[model samples]
Every structure is written in C-alpha cells, then in structure tokens.
Target: MGRVAGKKVFITGGAQGLGACFGHMLADEGAKVALTDINGEGAKKTAAAINEKHPGAAIAIAHDVTKKDQWESALGEAAEAMGGISVLINNAGIGTAGSIETESYENWRLTHEIDVDSIFIGTQLAMPYLKDNQPGSIINISSVAGLIADGMMLSYNSAKAAVWMMSKSIALHCARSGYDIRCNSVHPVFTRTPIVDPLIALGGGGEEGEKKLVRQIPLKRLGEPEDVGYCILYLASDESRFVTASEFKIDGGITAQ
Candidate 1:
C-alpha cells in the first residue's frame, strides 16, 4: 500500500480535479503531500479531506504558480511542513482552444504563462530542494495535445508542446549533473476533469457532449483521474528510479494511430 512511503510531495493546482485526485492517491500510498492552489481555501479543504483519510499526511498553501515570489514561499512552506520535498507535481494548467487566425495574442500569452511558464518556475525553484532530497522526481502534467497538433487549439498546442520539450531538457540536465531527481512529462487526453468543461460545453454539454469529445480516442471513453494518478504514483515512487526524460501517455491508444 505504501507505494511512495516516504515521499514529501508538493503539488500545484491541488484544490480540485486532477491535482486533488493525485494528492489523495499519493497520500493513500503513504506520501506526505502539500496541496497548493490559487484557491487557498479550496486547497485547505482538499488537504483536510486527505488528512481525514490519512491523518497528518497533507497540508495546504496559497500559491500562484506564475509568480516567482509565491513559488518561493510555497516551496519553503512545503519543505518545512513535510520535513523536505522529494517530489514536485506540476499539475496546474488550463485548456485553451482557438485557431491561429482566430486566437488573440492575449490568450496565447496567457496560455503559455499558466500552462508552460509555471512548470519552468516550479522546476527551477524546486530543484534545490529536490537535489537536497536525492532520488526525487518531478512530474509535469503535459497533455496529449502537446504530443499531437490540432488546428483549433493554437495556444494550447503551443504551450503544451513547450512543456513536453522542456521536460526532456530538464531531465537531461539533471542526469548530466548527477542528480537522482528524475523528470518526465505526462500526456493525458480528454480526461474527465474540469479542464475539459469548455470543450464539453462547446459540444453542447451533458453526456452527448462528453461522447463527442471521446470520438477521437480509440478507447471511446474519457480518462479517469485515477488513470493518470496511478502513473504519477509510479513516477513519484522509487520504482521508476531509472525512468526519466520520457513521456507517459494516458490517452487510451489515441496516439497509436
């Protein structure tokens, strides 16, 4: 049951959806988790819920990932609270859709600010702590959109692709520097998270909308949070100690085509 028995994990966007799901899942497997979100109260609630199930294993912090100052403060708080930070989960990101011609420059910039740039900040700030705690892991939540191109998702496509490449660069750097901190990116497709709400709404919402969203997925279903969480658990655990600089796709075989 203790897949990550001694891990001290700091997760961004932990207030709800995939972040909350990963927090609960990792804590269940014996990790002490620090849940940070822009929604301070929501992060507390999620942390409280986890503590209820796995007493004293979770904490909450108010963090705006895009801000350098906030990242420093939050990381310090987490390191102190958890005794040290062994894992960093860059799970906070937004979904954006617009063709290059239709997309505003503002949306493009905002998408990169949140989805791509935050990872850059988090990884840089967390590197010292991660290096201090050797054999650590950094999990960046990229998306299938990052691996595949879509004409309609201009900014999203650009941001996610940046995340994908950045992860590899970080991984290679850590390896060359002789650090035991492994870095990898996860690419999930059409997961049933709030991030996909806009897409669903565009499809008209409800079950019909969800179904329309899954048509491209060979499995014909949306990914459950647990699907990605389990993968993160492995990456966060020592089991994947030798695994780094790679991409893990939880896309139900959509990329197989």
Candidate 2:
C-alpha cells in the first residue's frame, strides 16, 4: 500500500499487540518505524522481526513513556535514525480494575501517569519535531471505556477519558497555529491484547470471561489488534489530513447500541 512510505513513526508500547501490529502494518506499507517499549529486549525482537520483513525499515528503543528525559532521548534518536519524525503513536497504557471505593489513590495516580501523563509528555516533547515535519499526525490509543463508563474500571476509564479529550485539545491548538499536526483518538472495545488479561482474570480467567465481553459487543467477537492498528495507520498518514479533533471507535459496533 505504501501508505506512509517516507514517514517516520515513533510508537510507544511498540513491542507487541497493537503496537507490534502498527509496526508491521506501517512497515509493510513502506514507513520507517521506531518501536519503543519498556521491555527493551522485546522491543528489539519486534523490531528485528519487522526488519526481517522489510529490511532497514525499523529500529527498537528501550523507552519509558512517562519519563521526560527518556522521551527527549527517544525522539532525538528516532529522528536521527529515521531522518525526521512524521508521526507519534501514544499507545503505551495500562488498565486497572477497581470501583472508586476499592481503588487506592496510588493505583489511580499510577494509571493516570501511565495512560494520561505519558501522552502529554510525549506530545509536548515531540511537538517541535512534528511542527518541523509538518502534515504529521498523532494517534492516541484510548478505549471505549474512555467514551463510556465502567463500574469496575474506574481508574482506566478516567485515564482513557482524559486522553480522549486531551487529543481534541491538541488538535485544536495545532489547527489554530497552522502546525499541520492532526490529532485524534481511537476507542477500541475489548481487543484481544494482553491489556485485557487482567479483566479476564477478574472475571473467572478463561474463555468464559471473554465470552461475557463478546456478548456485550454486537459483533459477538473480540477485536483483533489490526482492527485498531490500521485505523491508527490512517490517522498517522496524510489520508487523515482533513480529519482531526475526532474519535474513531473500533468497538465492533458496540457504541451503536
């Protein structure tokens, strides 16, 4: 497809699942990818695998998205490796289950830091590069819980919801400033990623818990990683140049009900 042939993309949480899917999807389409994850070895493995498929198309970095110093270092290195930055995918996040009464302030703070603050840090650090690149995009991987609410997912829901709105704010700022940096959030429902494993464990830990989730989804099945990754790919590419300050729901039609 060569959708983003010359684009340079920096993705957090790029070692696996939707992150790895984004790498494979974009590399296959001819984009240069910098895959960053907390698990540095895993990131290296994922990047190596991508290079095997599309020689010289990828590099892996050991990045902790929450740290400002690491964000600066990662973007600097990624820019050097790929020539410049054209896109940022703030895909690193975690889910925590707890009602307001049960969730500790510690967990709340951590969830917001990982899921929400990292986006802010990454975007702020990457803005200069993105502005220079022009016609770039930022895809924040939020969740359907961001769009709605869940009794058991208070921390995760709040964090993702913050991301959802934060994306819009950044989009508006870029537009007003003529930065050509479109921003949008993707809301996926129960994608079969490791992120959902805790939920599975909380609900009987097997196909049964997953089935319960699928039952709520009209599509009657869990989403695949690519389902969200390609949607992100579109937002990352110029195809979405006219689309910003919006949310894409890869929720298997769940929100329709």
Candidate 3:
C-alpha cells in the first residue's frame, strides 16, 4: 500500500475524473500530493478527502497549466508544501474530436494549449525540483491515439503524439545530466471518465457507446480510473527506476492489432 512512501507528488488536473483518481492512489500510498487544477474548488474537495484519509498528505491549488506563471507558482508552492517534489504527473488534457479537413484553427490551438503545452510547461518548471530528488518520475497522460491515428480525432492525435515524443527528449536530457529523473508517457485507449461522457451519451447513454469503443480493444472492455492509477503507482515508485523514456500503453491491447 505504501509503494510511493516519502515521495512528494504534484499532479496537474487533480480535481476530478482520472486526475482525482491519481491523487487518491498516490495519497493512499503515503505520498504527500499537491492537487492542482483549473477547478480549484473541486481540487480542494479532492485534497480534503485525501487528507481526511491520510491526514495532511495533500493540498489543492488553482492552476492553469497553459500559463507559465501559474506553472512556476504551483511548483514552488507544492515543493514547499511537501518539502520537495519528486513526481510530476502531467495529466491535464482535452480530447477534441474533429477531422483535419474540418477542424478550426481555434479548436486546434486550444487543444494544443491544454493537451500539449501543459506538458511542456509542467516538465520545464518541475525539472529542478525533480532533480533535487535525484530520482524522480514524470508521467504524462497521453493516449493510444498517440501511437495510432484516427481521422476524426485530429487535434487529439496531434497533441498526444507530441507528448509521446517530448517524453523521450526529456528522458534523454535527464539521463545525460545524470539526474535519474525518469520521464515516460502512459497511453490509455478509453476509460470511465467525464472525457468520454459525450461519447456515451451519443451511444444512447450508458454502455452502448462504450461498447462500440471497446470493440476496437482486444480486451473487450473499457478501462477504469484505477487501471491507469495502478500504472502511475508503479512508475512513481522505485520499481521502475531503470525504466525511462518509454511509452506504456494501457489500451487493452488495441496496439496489438
């Protein structure tokens, strides 16, 4: 249960959905977590619940990951709150569905700002704090769409692909500098989160839309928040010390096709 004990984690989008799940999983494992999201009130609620369970192990911050100033401030505040930051989970993203032929520049820009730019900003700002820990981990929540392409999800595909490549670049830099700060990306196909609610609604609400999506997955089921949460736990822990610059696909074997 205490896999990440003593580590201090700062997670972006740590208010609800998969982000809140990550906060819960980490806090339960004895890590003092800083939960930051645009929804400050929701993030506070999430942190309060975790603190109730773990006692003084969490804090919530208002954050807009696209803004550099906010990134810097959040990192500083979180580092102080937990003594030093050891793990940074760049989990804030948006999935915009549109074809390259029809997607507007504005839609594409906003998609990149949240899905791609945030990872860049968070990694740059969190690097020094992670270096201070000697061995730290940065988990970027990419998508299986990063590995493969779909005609309708143009912006989402582009953004996640950028995250996949960026993680490798950061991993190489950390290794050459001998910091032992591991960087990697986690790619999930689809899961039970608000992000997929629209699809479910389109599928007539409930499991119908998910059924169509899962047909593409060999596992024959959509993912749970805890599915991704457990993976983050492994990477945040020293168990994955030697694993860096790689991509972990939680796509229910979709990539196997």
Best by TM-score: 1
Taking every candidate in turn, the Cα RMSD to the unseen true structure, in Å, is 0.8, 1.0, 1.0
Across 133-250, the per-residue lDDT of candidate 3 in tens digits comes to 8689999999999999999999999999999999999999989988889999999988999999887777777677778877888999999999999999999999999999999998
Give me the displacement of residue 137 in model 1, in angstroms.
0.3
Worst 10-residue lDDT window for candidate 3 reads 199-208
RMSD of 2: 1.0
Q: What's each prediction's TM-score?
A: 0.98, 0.98, 0.98
Error of 2 at 33 (Å): 0.5
Clashing pairs for predicted structure model 1, backbone only: none
lDDT of 2 by residue, 134-178 (tens): 889999999999988989899999999999999999999999998
Stretches of candidate 2 above 4 Å error? none
Residue 30 miss distance in model 2 (angstroms)? 0.6
Top-lDDT structure, candidate number: 1
Shift of residue 87 alpha carbon in model 3, Å: 0.5
- The CA lDDT of each predicted structure is 0.94, 0.92, 0.92
lDDT of 2 at 223: 96
lDDT of 1 by residue, 46-139 (tens): 9999999999999999999999999999999999999999999999888888997899999999999999999998899999999999898999
